[model samples]
Target: MRLTDLISPDAVFATLKASTKKQLLQELSDRAAKLSGLPAREIFDALLHRERLGSTGIGEGIAIPHGKLGKVKSIFGIFARLERPVDFEALDGAPVDLVFLLIAPESSGADHLKALACAARMLRDPGLVATIRATRDHDALYSLIAQRSKPYAA
Candidate 1:
């Protein structure tokens, strides 16, 4: 369940400009719609409902907003680097600038969990996070994420 399995080059946005968490999710949902062929409104509504249960903000300037959709046949991801950090109600109370939005088929139970765990572990790497923040090019960001997500060589 590597990040590459869920995200492609086209799914990476290096500099997304949004003023609030809701705006960020909306933008991500719009992008996810184009990538996943799912309706943007449905995606947005699902994400909002999930957030109402609890904030996905995991601290250290990162947030993983995710949801399941009946229309999706497989898991999909969209990665974005915010142009400015915004309050996300993070547990640490820190603002978020890096976001990974994931959507999975409603029936993908174990696969969805594995993908989420893989993404969370990958983003927890401080070195990779720093590299991602240092670059503003979408291609570079995508390459960094994809390359770093590979299994570590012994």
Candidate 2:
């Protein structure tokens, strides 16, 4: 699945002030709740539950925290660039600055995995990650993700 297919411009935040991994997930979940109009607490709780299983940090200063929620009708994503790096227990043992939060319908099966895989593949590109880090506004950041995720569309 294309990143743009799941994320709206409103879900993107340019400057996220999360001092730690927990706070970062909360911030992202809150944004997703706002966009989806679901209870913020419920979303936060669901995402937190997923994190408890394991850290979503994919390494290289990036993390993709994802969960399934009953209230959601489709997959949704939120992108955030933290003002400072935070320990996310990443595989590379490095802190994370860029985060991608994904929420999918509870009934979704392979689609959720497909979306996460698509995001991970897109984020694996160093140049694209650098470009995303350089983005100074939400619109620009959303555009960058949209552009990068285009090639994977099927």
Candidate 3:
């Protein structure tokens, strides 16, 4: 799946402010609620429950927080670039500055995994991450993530 397929221009954010992981998740949950028409508290609780399982912080200053919700009809994602990195208990001990929050319908099993894998692969590209971090323009960030670009740079 392509990033553009899962994320919309309105869902892309830059230089978001959050001092802690919980606050960050809360912000994301609130945004997701507006986009998905679900209760913000429900989304927050779902994300919190997932975090209790283990940190989604996949290292290299990135975190992909995801959960399945019965209220959501399909998979959707929100990408946010934090104004400053925050402690996420990342496995590699790196604080997270970039986050991609994904939520899917409860019945979307295989589709959810595919979306997660797609987001992971995109963010794993160091060059792409650098490009994202270099700009605060929401439109540029959206293009960088949404465009079907060439091979990932090393």
Candidate 4:
């Protein structure tokens, strides 16, 4: 699945302020609830459950917090660039400024993994991430994510 398949222009946040990981997840869940038609509490709980397993903070100031829900029919995503980096218990112990929250249907299985891989592949590029962080314009951020990201950047 492509990144665009999970995210849209409205889902892209250029400058969100989150002081802590828990608050960030809660905010993401609230945003996702509006777009995904799922309850914010359920989404927050699912993300919390996933975090309990391990931090999704995948390094390079990025965190991809994801979860699955029975009510979801397809994968949905929310991306944010924080105004100030927040501690996410990243593997590299780096505070995260970039975040992507992915929510998928409980039965998605392989499709969910593929969507995660797609987002990870796109944002893993240092050059692209730099460009994303360089602009605060909502439309521009959306454009860069929608247009400039490489299909797979390792």
Q: Per-residue alpha-carbon lDDT of model 3 for 82-152, expressed as tens digits? A: 99999999899999999999999999888888788878888889988998989899999888886743332
TM agreement with the true structure for every prediction: 0.95, 0.94, 0.94, 0.95
lDDT of 1 by residue, 78-134 (tens): 999999999999989999999999898899888887777777899999999999899
RMSD of 3: 3.4
Q: In model 3, how large is the Cα lDDT of residue 23?
A: 96
User: Lowest lDDT 10-mer window, candidate 4?
Assistant: 145-154
In Å, residue 149's CA in model 4 sits off its true spot by: 4.4
Residue 55 error for model 4, in Å?
0.3
| Model 4 segments more than 4 A misplaced | 149-154
Candidate 2 TM-score, true structure as reference: 0.94
* Stretch of 10 with least lDDT, candidate 3: 145-154
| Model 4: colliding residue pairs | none
